[model samples]
Target: MAYVVFVGGLVVVLAGLTWFASWAKRRGRGSGVAGALAAYEEAYRTTAHQSHHELRQQADRKSESGSPDDL
Candidate 1:
């Protein structure tokens, strides 16, 4: 049980690190230890991708159209 707990903790830590890296990448934070990963993610997002920016733009347009549900 103790071993299992230790492994679980390690996995959780690693997953958190990955999530932080991804979050940093999306925010375009490319000037620290994770710069390379951030740049790679940015490139991927810009090439044949449909996330973040696209969805935000769509939502903005919808709001501009004055949709009642959005208000």
Candidate 2:
């Protein structure tokens, strides 16, 4: 039936993606799809959220400038 064919195609696509992800992982951290994903995540996090280190550095800079308005 048409439904069965559609489901089969979906399954095949999912399986291929799973395989590719595993392959990328095995290729290591600094290369291939895994590296690209890591770079993207780091960029997004840096822009979207402030880490503790970043917050501390910002606070230090404000204190150095002795500007209460910065707070």
Candidate 3:
């Protein structure tokens, strides 16, 4: 009997948490779980960062070349 009550209480707590998460998401606020996961990936993952300087250099070269028909 005690075990059954414990399990029921656990289920109610979990359901309440699920409802709160859905409400928060609808309000345009996250639980910060995504940001935490992103930070973890950035810390451990390679190729996660972009080279802005390299991108700018490529854009400059393309502009200088005008068009392919110029060649």
Candidate 4:
């Protein structure tokens, strides 16, 4: 009885996945490199923006502490 239930559950899960794949295909969600490139570009932009912001903040602190000529 337990084996039967397990097999039945697996069948249901697989059927659900099959249906989802079919739906995605119908919606033209085919897998391609564009999605990966977009993700990579977004990550690169975020990292660059964060580094620029930190550098600006550090420079501000240094200026506030007096210019290099004052040292």
Highest lDDT scorer: 4
lDDT of 1 by residue, 1-71 (tens): 99999999999999999999899889977456544544666787654234545654686784437668887
Model 3 scores worst on lDDT over the 10 consecutive residues at 46-55
RMSD of 2: 11.6
State residue 51's C-alpha deviation in candidate 3, in Å. 18
Clashes of each: 0, 0, 0, 0
Model 4 regions more than 4 Å off: 30-71
* Predicted structure 4: lDDT: 0.73
What tens-digit string does per-residue lDDT give for candidate 4 at 1-71?
99999999999999999998889889867455445654665577777556656665796785446668987
Give a tens-digit lDDT track for model 3, residues 30-57: 7377566556656776344234334545
Taken over the whole model, the C-alpha lDDT of each candidate is 0.70, 0.68, 0.70, 0.73
Task: Give the TM-score (vs. native) of candidate 1.
Answer: 0.44
* TM-score for all models, in order of appearance: 0.44, 0.45, 0.53, 0.43
Q: Can you list the residue pairs that collide in candidate 2?
A: none
- Candidate no. 3 TM-score: 0.53
Q: Is candidate 2 or candidate 4 better by lDDT?
A: 4
lDDT of 2 by residue, 1-71 (tens): 99999999999999998998788678754355444655675777665234534654686784446569878
Candidate 1 CA-lDDT value: 0.70
The TM-score of candidate 4 is: 0.43
Which candidate should be chosen as best, given TM-score against the real structure? 3
